[model samples]
Target: MTDTDLEIFAVAPPGLEPALLPEFRALGYKDARYGAGGVTMMGGWADVWRLNLELRGATKVLARIGSFRAMSLAGLDHRADEFPWDETFYSGTTVRVEATCKRSKIYHAGAAIERVERALLKAGMKPSADGEVTLKVRIEQNIVTLSVDTSGESLHKRGHKEAVGKAPMRENLAALFLRQAGYDGAEPVLDPMCGSGTFVIEAAEIAEGLQAGRSRRFAFETLASFDAVDYKALRRAVSVVKGPARFFGSDRDAGTLKGAVANADRAGLSAICDFQCKPLSELKRPDGAAGLVIVNPPYGGRIGDKKQLYALYASLGTAMKTQFSGWRVAIVTSEPGLAQATGLPLSQGPAIPHGGMKVWLFQTPPLK
Candidate 1:
């Protein structure tokens, strides 16, 4: 495939593909479509870099290098050897090859990995356990699709949130949740039960028009198609958005609030982010244009007891109804009963797999 016409896939958290699709379309990828696990579109290497740098909801950006039909391991080896690996990787680059086989003659994943790694060795690229780049080989129905993980680390690691509380929300997932809650960075956001300030920081960054990957290094930087000058221009082209909206977060634990403050500072969003050490009972609506109250609270696990959490959710509901008139609310939890305790006019979104359990986003329209 030519560098200008590569298939780019942005991996999304399962069940949030709908929320992520619009973000791609919003960025001018009109043909971006939702697949089983993510979104896919055709773009050049520059588009790959831009997606990695700008899209906050994607977990990984993969470039489909090429695909070929191989009926057996020997044929796979032949095709792999003939494929132009030098076009993607520089000579002697360390890479990790992971293979998955389904409905194919080459059913053994280990054997397929061996063949691909052997081909890489012959191509002068070293296959190591701790490789900087990851090459994913998927063999399904005799079609071998070779894709490179252009995002070395998960996009969730925006590289600034160093301190996170127990079961803290992932940034990418938080961004998707915000979008699901109808947040567009035009209004203020408040996370009453914020831990390590993920939602608050993400909302602030969106409001300020900050690039998601501004502080992180990407695997694409090491690829042969990467142009440093073009990337720098892409980074510089993003203009910071100034708005009247502000983001706020509060937690009962002062220690957690400290970390949240530090996280916002590291993200260069301290000016727009405000963290307070307050209980759910004390969460008041900020004095200004009402926006969204997005929260991820405990669900009877290590965070709190199930029985007691009902009261907490009820308190949250009471606070929202009494003090936060005209603002929208979104709560994420694994239990429907907990959400019911809130007594808010809520609608449930798709079940999202988070922290080893299926959780959901429950949202309410602007309260009267």
Candidate 2:
């Protein structure tokens, strides 16, 4: 968190690393590349600020502040307490400490967390039993690396979209999925099972050339290293070019549709989004050019019968075949069997973690 350039990690949902790498490259991040858990690159405070602000696919952006070797609890305690806490955090700030131990002599993660918390307490910082800012420690082979959670509430919160429906796709993941479907600005987009209209709304934002962080706040804004003037300038630097595209979303639930409308309105995207209380079997061709049709249909865990989900998927596939030809398709489902029931000639990405379930993206070329 100094003026010197440092490492930045854009944490992606597991298995979506490939999907997120191009996004960082497009943003012009230096040495932008994907690793096991996320994308990593080097930057300064400004870059740290930008990633937390702009990245749509990152679940969190962690700034690797510093590291040390801690063979024992006492070693961890001494170095953690002596680390320059004042440089990054505001005085009297409350911080939560989280640690992970692997292949290390200090194998107890909870004990490691206690020692780090103790260090922070003695350094004039309060140990928040609950708070946003966190001091994350990773212990491996007796090496301890310390970093701060620059994204306070996880980037998916986005500050907008207040009314989230049951098992809604996170805005970050929605944005990345849209990108994976090869969605750019000009083409229209549709989400038939649009829970809270995340997919449609995110597509509209991208089409309108909006910054993902436009309506959000980041934890970096609360840090001592933050520069208000420079941040303001960066915010102002976003250029927008409104497109002629309209994004469409529909669901059977009236309450869900209403929530989607309100969420879109809050995000200033109601003008470019359409929401309706209509089931998939009743869907028709939207009044526009062919585009992408992305849906996160009921995975049947908490709603409806799993036995009937196959029939629902079959019906959806038939509906798409009859109504949405020439439009590509992307469906996210926890059940590969249910996805196969679609019979949509689909290809899948790696199963990704979502709401404690592993969901895969089943995609198809435009219908004949």
Q: Indicate the worst ten consecutive residues by lDDT in candidate 2.
A: 236-245
Candidate 2 lDDT over residue span 1-368, tens digit each: 34546888889988889889988878886488898999988889888888877788999989988999989999988898899988877778888888899999999999999998887778788888685588888999999988888988888887788888988899989888888888886788988888798899888877766777877777888888889999887774444334343789999999989999999888777767888899888898888789999999888876678898998899889988889889999998898999999889899888888888888889999899
- How displaced is residue 200 in candidate 1, in Å? 0.5
Candidate 1 has its poorest 10 consecutive residues by lDDT at: 236-245
Per-candidate total of colliding backbone pairs:
0, 0
Q: Compared with the true structure, what per-residue lDDT tens digits does model 1 show for residues 243-306?
A: 3438889999999899999998787777778889998877778889999999999998567889
Clashes of 2: 0
Instruction: Give me the overall lDDT of model 1.
Output: 0.91
Candidate lDDT values, in order: 0.91, 0.85
Those runs of model 1 whose alpha carbons end farther than 4 Å from true positions after fitting are: 1-3, 237-245
